[model samples]
Target: DESIDIPYFGELNGIQLVNPIWVKAVPYNVKVVGANNNVVTHLRLWSTEPSKKQLVQDEKYLKMVSKISESLYPDDSTDEGKILRLQQQYLFSSAGIQDAIREHKALGRDIKDLPKYYTFQINDTHPTLIIPELMRILMDEEYMGYDEAWSIVTQVAAYTNHTILAEALEKWNIELFKRLLPRIYQIVEEMDRRFRLFLKGKNLSQDKINHMALIGSHDVRMAHICIYGSFSVNGVAALHTNILKEIELNDFYQIYPEKFNNKTNGVTHRRWLMHINPELVNILDKTVKGNWRKDLSAIKELENFKDDESIQKEIKNMKLAKKRQLIDVIYKDTGVKLDENAIFDIQIKRLHEYKRQSLNIFHVIYLYLRLKKDANFRKTFHPQNFIFGAKAAPSYIMAKYIIEIINRAAQIINNDPETKDLLKVVFVQNYNVTYAEYLFPAADLSEQISTASKEASGTGNMKFMVNGAITIGTMDGANVEIVEYAGIENEIIFGLSAEEVTQAYKANSYNPRKIFDNDKRIQDVFKFIKSLDKDEHYFDFVFNNLLNVDYFFVLADFDAYVEAQSRANKLYQDEKTWWRMSIMNIANAGFFSSDRTIKQYNEEIWHLDTIKL
Candidate 1:
């Protein structure tokens, strides 16, 4: 671990800081090792550590200090959890700003020229406190005027909005915020008052002004602070950015049009492609004959050999090898032997209602029922191993229920004599980064099947595409950009468009009960869910949520998703066509590289000069 001295402030002019103790920044460098076991690069990950003296203090203080650097997003169901989460945010943000300023001044750069020498990227609402924190430091410590400090803060900071979900955009209770950090609260209150006056001067209505207020009636809206404070506000994908402008944050976008932009999220091709699937990398190396690793656009040259029988055979073999490796891992981990020959359809992400883990399982139940009842389907159906990997948040009861249901469904489906061979379900426990190394490369079908307009740009979709998995997804988030890059024919696009979903929500026209009653397939799936537990209707909460609320339109998109799955199943039967599409997906995936995403951020927003090591 590399240690850096972090100037911690317990009090600045009689104001208590977030964590009232001096701490050390002991960050370890995460090595990105290549397939050949050589360290390709290093990603320095920063973390907090209390001083040795503080470690020997009273138990209560040590516990409080430790909570600051503990696991992220702790259960905020109680007041204590909320305070800890807020404290964690301030702890990191305050330390980071202090470190940056110290480093800048140590280099003999003037405080007024801080914006020219450095820029801060506020990744999301979690770091929104940085704006006010910076303002406080400049005004109090550097003795700058409020206007000058605000000017410097605006120029140095930028924000990225990663979600459209209201719950995900953080807000702190005003009382709690004020009680914890009095000085920071004071600065934020003044900033809010100033911004409100600025908005009123623009002739905006009071309702609009209130809607865009940083400090609301009872709470401090973090996103509002970010939008008003930062010079640039970007979304993670093309569709996501458009949604923010038109629907989610339209008020802010209308006022600050020039600040809004799009930078579709991406995954590292070197780690996702080269390290994860070295066999595929070797094949591409032989066929493309270019430095595809350095300039991923060179990977598109593989399109020339897409139709070649020899290349197709090689790709098929590589995929099968990966599947076999995954099968062994699943057997070791879960004691469920996956069929290497079966289509490896994977949906792995955070367990959330919008991401629709329930929707995926509903389709699995439908297929299981079809195999039992339909003779033609039993004869003609291609075998499939439906794999799921996810971890629900501790406090999210519904998400946790979905995980239980997926596992319960897996248990029933895998043990069934009638469908065990043809259809197998495997929910890998404790899904994390290590398991993802196996899951991404082995996938035959990547399920980006969230309800329309829900997901921010999903890097998982890009990871699956780069590793040659055909996507069966809704036209949402980065899936839209994936289709544009990989071609529509190469992917299985389904469900409501983002605009249609938005219109449905706006019109309040969606009725899940009607769709459930109309569709016999959906009814059969629910029947299976009901039968999973005889003593009680354990999953009735899920059923009720779907019928009563259906916030994500799972029932509305059910028929379309099933049809798309059928199409993918049939397409998988044709070896030549499947391999060709897989090749095409890999070739076109160069556009979704992290290298491309970073380049765009530097060119458009940051404009930081490149320096040689």
Candidate 2:
């Protein structure tokens, strides 16, 4: 198995050294057992088993293993680690470009014709080094001139930005960039120079030109490189695209207004709807006309079924079935049993402060406090199960702290005799793609509570919509579009709009501390967080974060969020209306199909004709 014959390409002198290459599949979850782990020992044994002529090829691999063991780390948070990541990017991109050229050569096509055959859309700035790498291949390897290489490279590449978070924007220090990639850096430097001259020719201000430059004061902005090298630059959603034009990438937008565009993010309904909710798919297949699978717009026909009692009841039954499946999983994983009758209010995404998992937890705490304070409200209140699933990035201290508090709150509330059955709390561990298939459909309410203007676009919101879960969300990201599709009365929309949030920041008029002091309900929530018995140390930071730095405006939107929840609860009491709203969500979600998105991309951006199977 290790001596499997494969196509070989030698880097040195372009001659094959080995007739066959030894390839091995390594498990990611291999046990660490001192010096001889399973992977290491297995590889070591395979290499030492001798060759046909009894030549020892083992030493070469042993040396490689030793070097890898010494250089590689468990924690990729250091300068060396950062450099390693850059090295990986360069290696992957360079190799991929080389392969593409090899394929072009096999077809007997001129290298300049590469643009007609291939267009690489760089999703985010991760693979942006490929632009310069391709240029280097053309100019250096193929002996093409700089102008010719630049033209071909520009035609073959496009970029899509997914986030406006400053930290998420990729930038490499000039020293590290030049040291690691001397040739690519040279090409980038020339590109930056040409861009600056082009801006000067347009009579643009030097300040604005500097802001839009590929290379900044001490670093090379990867996004700027992407924008400069690519034929087009796009954002993931409409609002996100507008914000990119007006705010984040404003300088670039001004210079190349024609290059900027919007492609609102979409999810594959085949995965989110057809596969995940097969029962609902079966019902739709029976009731809805035409092939809705191929033509998602046909899902709009389900709007007529909204008023039908039988269909509404069937939808409710489907949700209950999903809840039963999820409850079994929760119990198996976390040993926490959830009530089937309780409202399954779910918030699941990556743990980030802006996404506002903390706000959800705070509202849960407020409800707990209310139950403890008022007997009549406790008796009358709807039984609710607040479910959460998230994973914090290892380096993000605040996100990890947020997870800890959520778990801490869950532990306290779920154990309390008074609140255990009345209000359950569960935070599912290691939430992933496999889990989402089960999670989205079972939800009574979907939480899309990211701060207004902060979220790029949430496909999870769309997935939930297709699965018939009503969103209680801010008018941000695709949620604005979702509200429009579902009707404003259906999806709970409560928050400052993007313009209002931006204006508040411009005026420097917003203060979280004032809200904390002024609002009793918010004050009580903060007080409870401070007074929590478990994780007392973390509570101080959480308290400080709110009073001193509520960057996501959790306290600012707290009242509106709570009022929305109250409204949701009241509406849930009217089962007929709630199911009708859920049906509306399912009907409107047809527009969110990735088939439509890809069709748009093919027509507008990629300009490629579809090939029928």
Cα TM-score per model: 0.94, 0.88
Tens-place lDDT digits, model 2, residues 397-482: 88877887788788889999987888988899889999988899899899999999999998999999999999999988999889
Give the per-residue lDDT of model 1 (tens digit) for 141-200: 899999999999999999999999999899999989887777888899899999999999
Angstrom error of the Cα, residue 422, model 2: value is 1.6
Identify the runs in model 2 with alpha carbons over 4 angstroms from their true place: 1-76, 533-535
Instruction: For model 1, give the 10-residue run with minimal summed lDDT.
Output: 1-10
Error of 2 at 71 (Å): 15
Candidate 1: stretches off by over 4 Å? 1-57
What is the Cα-based TM-score of model 1? 0.94
